[model samples]
Target: MLIVILPDDSRREFDDGVSAYDVAAGISGGLARAAIAAEVDGELRDLHAPLVVAEANGTSGKTAGTSPAARSAGAREVNVRVITKKDPEALGIMRHSAAHVMAQAVMRLHQGVGLAFGPTTATGFYYDFQLDKPLSEEDFPAIEAEMAKIVAADERFERMIVPRAKAVEMCRELGQKLKVEHIETGLAGEETLSFYRQGEFLDLCRGKHIPSTGHIGKAFKLLSVAGAYWKGDASRDQLQRLYATAYFDKKELTDYLTQLEEAKRRDHRVLGKQLELFTISQTVGSGLILWLPKGAVIRQTLEDYLKVELRRRGYDAVYTPNIGKIELYQISGHFPYYSDSQFPPIDLSEREGQKPGEGERYLLKPMNCPHHIMIYKSKPRSYRDLPVRLAEFGTVYRFEQSGELNGMTRVRGFCQDDAHIFCTEEQVADEFRGCLEMTQTVLKSLGMNNYRVRLGFRDPNGDKYVGKPEVWDRAEASLKAVCESMNLPDMSVEAGEAAFYGPKADFVVTDCIGREWQLGTVQLDYNLPSKERFGLEYTGADNAPHQPVMIHRAPLGSMERFVGVLIEHFAGAFPLWLAPEQARVLTVSEKSEEYGREVEQKLKEAGFRVTGDYRGSKLGAKIREAQLGLIPYMLVVGEKDAAEGTVTVRDRLEGDIGAMPLAEAMAKLQAEVAAKTVRQVADGGAPPPPIDRGPKNEY
Candidate 1:
């Protein structure tokens, strides 16, 4: 007999080799029916996998206060936790199964199809298939229909583990050359491989799949199709990537589809064009954004707002050139390391006006940190001058692949609200806290209240990092200490997401529509100031040279991307202060045209963005045009109001208000602007007044 340690610390006796499914059946019939997989020693595994122990122990009763590993490591026990349909891991298993079902459906519908890998993504799953022809949206319905048939048949998924050689032979026998090549290149190190078979379809995968196809239900959808190179290599064969998503229930799928439609409606590219806020011209470039007057106002307002806070925080502004010597990046380890993502270096040595070897090569600045590092090393400093804070709205460039570029979110050229601080090791925690506070302040000021903090730590087993393990530990501990002191909520730790230099903190903000965007970040680096690199050092109290710790932070990561998210978040209906045109004066007739001009001039002189519409069109047409343009307020100047020294107010969302004195109207609008009131007009309700608050975010 073998002792099985359940999650609740209860002990159960089972014969050797008893499967997880059998254990679930022993617990309850409902759980056995609902069980999709199980957790074995904290690793997810198929339910059909056998659970066994080396020997039987006489141990009985609950094991209290002991770790799960300690109990499972006993001579005669194995830990088993049955996973039901409600488990989070179950969704990932089902999505992987759905990808297999999709691949099978495509094979059944077409001939001579070669299947590569079909993997699950954060949102859903996609399969890359080497097909005879390209597939489009028109073909999705037929594929989904076939997938439905397969799901209805409820075919059981059979897992077969085989040696590496046999797996290659199986792929060859199935005429899947892509799989054979993958096994040869990507899976060559594995001694054995796992393959799953359902009906006439089989694929090589190490999977924790659902028991059968029927568990997928009818919530699966084939969303789109795009061309992808095999292994993401442009030199490899071009394959068709069928993007898809799935859920356990129809309502969940329906809700997801609704969100997708809403996201489409909120797409910044379409709205950018419709609202005339920004443009991407083919003549200029694909990824470069041309911020129109309206968009410029929004960007400028954000900069001014942050600049005020920065000044209060005692940060000094600095400027850097757009290009620098290639050797600078080489010294910073960004030259060859990130060369693929950077534009080709400018070889000035061959310029017509330059002699041989007179000019060295240059590169477009990929990051602002290296330049700031040089700035920090420019002058001698002592312990008293430590914690030097420098900030800039520095523009950087990257060579993003054309396919990956999407509007302002993923662009080649963009400006970063970048800042760097150099401080002593003892002051690392304090400076980091200030950065965290600043980031949260920015998010809260913009009314982005729904956000979570993520601490990115280095992977213990990974060697991609450049800092010493001890230094990395210190830096990570400092950041954690600050976060704990501040008592940040909804925080999570993600390993292997840290920068090459050091660990970092990221703020992932969720918009009103439930889409999360990464907007702010603070990174702690111990690698850049090392003696092997820039040899940056400041005099300590003992008069010895000591390397200072560097903190890299950007509250607004990218101005263009932040504006893009803001555009979608508010649907282009900006707040009073951020609006390009705060108020537009519309004339009731030609008689009031002169008065409308006066009203526009008065608001403009009072430091408001105001415009006058003295068109010959009717008043209704003018109001409708302003409303479509997303103007916040419309001051109606009719002959009656002009004579009374008043104006009728028309709000974009609240409709019309009674006439008020011109002075009173200006004061009301000014108050709203001064408060930076953010109205959620998308939901058709006015939000509460904006209060001046600090970084207290409520989930």
Candidate 2:
């Protein structure tokens, strides 16, 4: 007999070889009916799979062979639970299924369409199809309708394992060119292949699909259609990709759609245009942003604020040229490593042939670390000068694929709030802790409190990373020790995701709409060729030259991406200190224009971003316009208030706060600005109130 433990600690003993479906049936008929799949010791599997003998070393050393009779006795345990298709089963399965469904629907509708591959993505799923007739958006509805009918039929999804040659013959008979190609490509080592079938549709797959088509429900939607190269090679065949999304429940599907809509509404590209902050004109080209005055103001505010913080934290700001000679990249080892992402170098020989043998070549800077390393090497250093932090808001350029060019998020040219620290191995822990604290402070100040830390590590088998095994081990250990010592909660470690040079730790923040963005990062690089090529050395107290460890940290990542996130985070409503136009003084009538101008000047003198609304418009219209612009405050100066040396303050998102003396109001505003308070207002006329959200999760 075999005993299986459930999530609720209930155990069911069954005869040997009894499948998970039988266990569910023993629990209750309803549960058995609801079971679509099962998780056998954390590995998701088909419900029909047998519950074999428990393995000795279960996950985490937990045992799976405990007897049900030993209820009160302590024993290592293994958990078994049923999984529905609705659960997140890694996007790969979902995308693969979506692709199968798409192919099935296509074959049913257009008998000539050929299949290639369908894959799941971070957000959704897509399938590629080769057809004589090009697919368009207009065809999505019919395809979706056909899919729905197939789902309603409740056809059983069956899997079969067959010999490779037999599978090839079957595919050839079906005229599935792509399947035959996939087999002939010799990517698989097994003699047998796995195939899935539902009704008249069958395809090659390695699957853990829902038991029946009915499990798909009505929560699927076809999103869009686009053309893609078959294998991402320009010279390869072109295929049409059908994008779609599926969820476990209708409400979840609705929520996803609603979130997508909200995302579109808060798109930086759209808001950037509506606010007249930036632009990317066809005349200039793609992937380049042209920041106008308004955008520049916000960018400057962020840069200045970060600069002040960096300086206060003992960082020395530095600047470097936008372009450098090709040899510099060669010395830095960036040429071969990042060659694909860099713009081709400018060949000066073509222009200056007279200077023979002096054929200088230059390329735009892709990162600031190499230049910062040069600065560190320019002078001698000792143990006393250890932990030297160099910072820069350096602008760099890279050639991003045109298809991947996002508004400000992914651009060709952008400024990084980059910094590097040269420290002894002993100081690595403290320096890393400081970087984490600074990153937390920056995110908190920007109202991004919900974030998690990811420790990215090197892949032992990969040839891309630079450092030796021992060096990589030490660096990764140091970072891990720092994270553990700091007791940082909600931290996860992912191996094989490290940068090409070294291991790193990243801070990922989720926006209000539940979309995650990587805002800050700290990397431990033990092997940059520049350090060796430039012969950098620092003298220890023992008078021996030692190689100082280098730490690369970026609190805000890049100015462009940070601002883009900030725009969406606040929905264009910036805080008082960061707002371009903080307050506007409006007059109830033309008679009070003088008082409004005086109030604006006084506020400006007091170090507030203030403007006067002296337009020939009604007082209510002016107040409404100021609110729409998301100004922090609007001072309405009427004849009575002007004569009384006071102003009626109208708050954004808040209605009104009766007249107050100009000096008192200014003092209050200053306090709010200094405290970085986020004031919320009620629907009716009321004073602005403190934010009601509780203390944020700080770890």
lDDT of 2: 0.79
User: 363-421, model 1: which lDDT tens digit per residue?
Assistant: 99999999999999999999999899999999999998776778988899999999999
**lDDT of all the models against the reference?**
0.86, 0.79
User: In candidate 1, residue 417 scores what lDDT?
Assistant: 99
Ten contiguous residues minimizing lDDT sum, candidate 1: 690-699
- Taking the tens digit of each residue's C-alpha lDDT, what string does model 2 give over 127-213? 778888888889989999999898889888888878989989988988988778787674357688878899989888767667777
Show model 2 residue runs off by greater than 4 Å.
1-92, 114-116, 130-141, 156-196, 202-208, 226-240, 325-333, 348-362, 461-463, 529-535, 680-699
The alpha-carbon deviation from the true structure for residue 130 of candidate 2, after best TM-score superposition, in angstroms, is: 4.6
